[model samples]
Target chain A: MIDLQEMILEKDRLIPLLRKLKKESRLIAPVTNKHGDTLLSEINNIDRDTIDLDRQPQNSLKSFFLPQQEILAHYSVDTTGYNFTAPEAAKETIYFGVRSCDLTALLYMDLIFSKPAKDASYYDRRNRSVIITLGCNDPFANCFCEATNSGPYLDYGYDLQFIDLGSSYYVAAGRRKGADLLNKWDYFFRTVEEEDQKIRYQLFLEARGRFNRNIQVSHACHKLQEEEVAETIWEKLAGRCYDCGGCAYVCPTCTCFSVDDMAIDDSHGTRIRSWDACTSSGFTRMAGNHNPTDRTRHALKQRFLHKLKYDYQKHGKASCTGCGRCVDICFGGVDITTFIEMFTRDAS
Target chain B: MNTNFIPATAVIREIIRENDTISTFRLELINKRVPFSFRSGQFCMLSVPHCGEAAISISSAPNALPLFDLSIRNAGELTNAMHQMKAGEQVGIRGPFGTPFPMADFANSDMLFVAGGIGLAPLKSVIDHCLFQSGLEADAVANITLLYGSRSPSEVAFTTAISSWKEQGIDCRLTVDAGDDSWHANVGLVTELLQKELITKNTKSLICGPPVMIRFVIARLTEMGCASHDIFTTLERHMKCGMGTCGHCHLDGKLVCVDGPVFSLEQLQTMDVMELGT
Candidate 1:
């Protein structure tokens, strides 16, 4: 095996490096809030002890890629006439301390925007940025990344991955860009020996054991295709759903959006695109009285089945990562774990 | 400042008043030297300055001379403003957005067109294309029928053009919801006209109307031996933007703006149909 590249930084040196990076680029890191939950925020300075490596961040990484509100196109109407204009360009960003699960989520978003009909705006932000992931040293109670075939360490989709090793960090370069960043500052990192690799492996194994939740839906895409599964079960599962669209809002994979044209004046207007959720009642309401999926139960059923069944059939992977954000965020506490357990047993 | 949202200037060349509340405007792009191509059954987002925008389908054939036609029902703010305009007035047009009707799929098949009220606006594009003898073989127009219904004779759209097609020996059936003393056509809901056995087992049906009419017509067509794949319908939703970015027009995972405003019954079967405000 190749010798792992390692970096040794004194607590004082690490703080200074984070501060220096902040000056040159937009740097985001996980910081613990008053409630003890970790959230990714803009960091001007770093406290090594301030990093919370346990549990997924409260928010998904999608906000960095697809903002909540973006100007899609602009329209201006004047006595002379109306004109259409595209939105302004985006800025470069560096997302630091992202979790492996969230990084995997970004990779899935790449597939969505890079499809045959490409979304240029999404592609613009994604391609220009740098992603730095932090390995999870301790798994949370709700995390089921193991079940989703993702984990604590960056298997893929990160520029650089930092493994927390008590006094120092074991930095592994996952991409050429990451390697170049290290090479440019070669004075900071020292070569890691064979013995250091054993300790890192041990930590990974212990971290795996700490995770309480394990999902087992290996062939989720294939299982949902069985015609024998009755539609009545969806009705039963949907009974408890409130149709508030909270699950979609918190989901890392849900990418639905809506566009609106705001008339600024007679000659000028702005057409804005904002995130939309399928769980809302107005999602399918047509003009002059037509709505195909008008019922709350039906909308709820479609939201879950689309993520679990339909998207998998089309994209070759389930859209859900078993992050349990939807479960925790829901007002009704409608846990997806319960549904998965019930659906698997019923299908068998 | 971006130019992407700016609509091209198109002048109204002619206006055909369909009813007291509805009219079809024939618009010519000011720069007629450039070709503006759009398929039949595709809708455009029309904008009237100071009023707002509305999704309106192209009502004329692709090869129609001089100007393209937009049939507007003066119910909304944009359409109400549009009704006041006359020839030489300029309006903004965006799109030719959404998926158009699958013309190639209907080749060599016996076709049936069912329309009710203003739902005929979008279907008129298909009707014009099929009736035109330019590119299509003479045999392709055979075995076609149009079943049109309105509340009254006064509410019927494209009356002059439809009568001309009827005079040209096209099989056209007209009906009214409540007929007057002068009315000679079948009188009832548009679905009642289906009882006349105008369609055969081999006919492919296309239905467009209000939701209530579409649902009733679909049930009647199904009863008349129309298979799910052979039946197609157009849907209209609150489309704030013509792009799929807007979530308003979504029906399940499908975006009506992108996946379709037009879909076959086979595609609709996968969707969940529910009552409004439930």
Candidate 2:
């Protein structure tokens, strides 16, 4: 039996491993569909599908743990009483080729759902899912995970991780399940040699150099905690914000949600929890139409403060993963990187 | 789907009409595996079948087991639907969440409760708990002073319980913003009532009202020599999940559902947010 902790996979063995992963469990990977948009989607035909490792996927890893919308319970009311039944169990699936930024974001999400009160549904999906991450050897233009100390090359937060080598892939197991996968498919992996270790260390250093060095995520967080930022900065950010809620929808760490009970008929229905954004005016508005942060600027400030400052105070680290997905997707041009630039410009 | 978001069934035992738009509902948990117990100032997510849910405070004190009160006003969609709900109908309920009032701290202090409009709901729980305690717990409180105000005489909640509350040795003072012919009592704001009343050195003031009313009351209490630490208030925000997981109820990293719905002036001061304006 091969030691599953660290192993090497040849370029020729990649297709066989993919075929095995697809047949064993539900496999989701980054693939460009017929529409020419690359997304993390289920692989039905392994032979036809091509995985995209060049760029970060458009969507984050949140959907696998916390879905955009899900039914909490099925309810029925009659003359006797009310009855509520929990939804069916989640299916076991494997998410492959996830980037280090998403893997780190998953860790942040795990903390949010488990602490204070356990979200059973989130844990259910999380427990059943297997994550196989891919190391970022060539970082994206907007990528700055190094600033948050979350990625580029992750030390942890995956069952298995793959660091790309020219002729072969350096595979390492971070969990028991990953070791089990290697044990099951022993023919695909060879034991790591001394030369492979030297190459891995060299690749790690080169990957570190590829990130944007100007971004200072931790410094901005420190400045936010020390003193109040100017209101003009918030106003300027708010002016550009259209309140489209796209940033939150695309955000990996934003976990705000609202529950609604939809009726099937007079007697039966289901209660659903859908993704809700804090940037929206109606998020904090009370029943009597009393809103504390009524202005768009106030909401904008609240979002950044929660991400950059408030989360640091609560969790001892900022919530942002520096994936820069929001930077790439936000239509209003309200990005965290820009805010960090503005914050560090005059304040710190 | 999270089982934590699933609400247990609560049967409405009694619906007491407090006013035209507001009513006090007494609910009993039908399928509770564990006995439900909540202290005063904690709230529950009250949901109508098909309408929606709102974070409503538990109005009744801790004495009643299983059965609790939620005084709701016809303010928005979910609340308007709740008002239309009759006794014997079923509604969804989760929690008794948020930080409870500091009952232990106020044990030996002279209690001053200042309430305005629907803000009186949560404070009523604290007041009832203080007055209706058994044995040494009852004697722990020096005296109970309740200053309640509404928009009009007709809008006063818990009218039926007022006489009994007074009989139980509570110094209940009623006021209205503008009084009608029937209202022979004080025809001024509740904060003005604080001027005429004398506050002792050993007093702890609990104020709950509209944001404007709360601000003025806090100002009055400060002038009356009440320390910021001794004054407490309950805050309200739109909440979907009563648990801290949901970020909707967050007031500058402090999840109102978990960290507070109840916070002292000193506690709010420490949270460096502009809206709190500490």
lDDT (tens digit, per residue) of candidate 2 on A72-188: 888887877777789988888999989888888889888898877778888888898889999988888888889888888888768899988888999998887888888889888
Where is the poorest 10-residue window by lDDT in model 2 chain B?
B269-278
TM-score of candidate 1's A chain against the true A chain: 0.89
Among these predicted structures, which one has the highest DockQ? Answer: 2
Tens-digit per-residue lDDT, B1-278, candidate 1: 22334456788889999888779999977643256788887888787765556778898989794579999887765678899998878887767788888887776667788998788888888878877742577436456788898989778777887887787666888999888988988888878778647776667888888777888888888787888999998887777667665456766567777888888888887765431111
> lDDT of each prediction vs. the true structure?
0.73, 0.85
Rate residue B115 of model 1 by lDDT. 91
lDDT of 1 by residue, A1-348 (tens): 323345544344556666666676777777777688787776644654376555568888877777788776676655655555568776667777888888888888887665434576787777778787888888767888777766767676678888877766677877776666667666666667676677779999998888787665555546667643456655665676777778887788788776556677556767665677877777765544455663644546666666677777777777777667886877765656656666667744
Clashes of 2: 0
RMSD in order of candidates: 4.0, 1.9
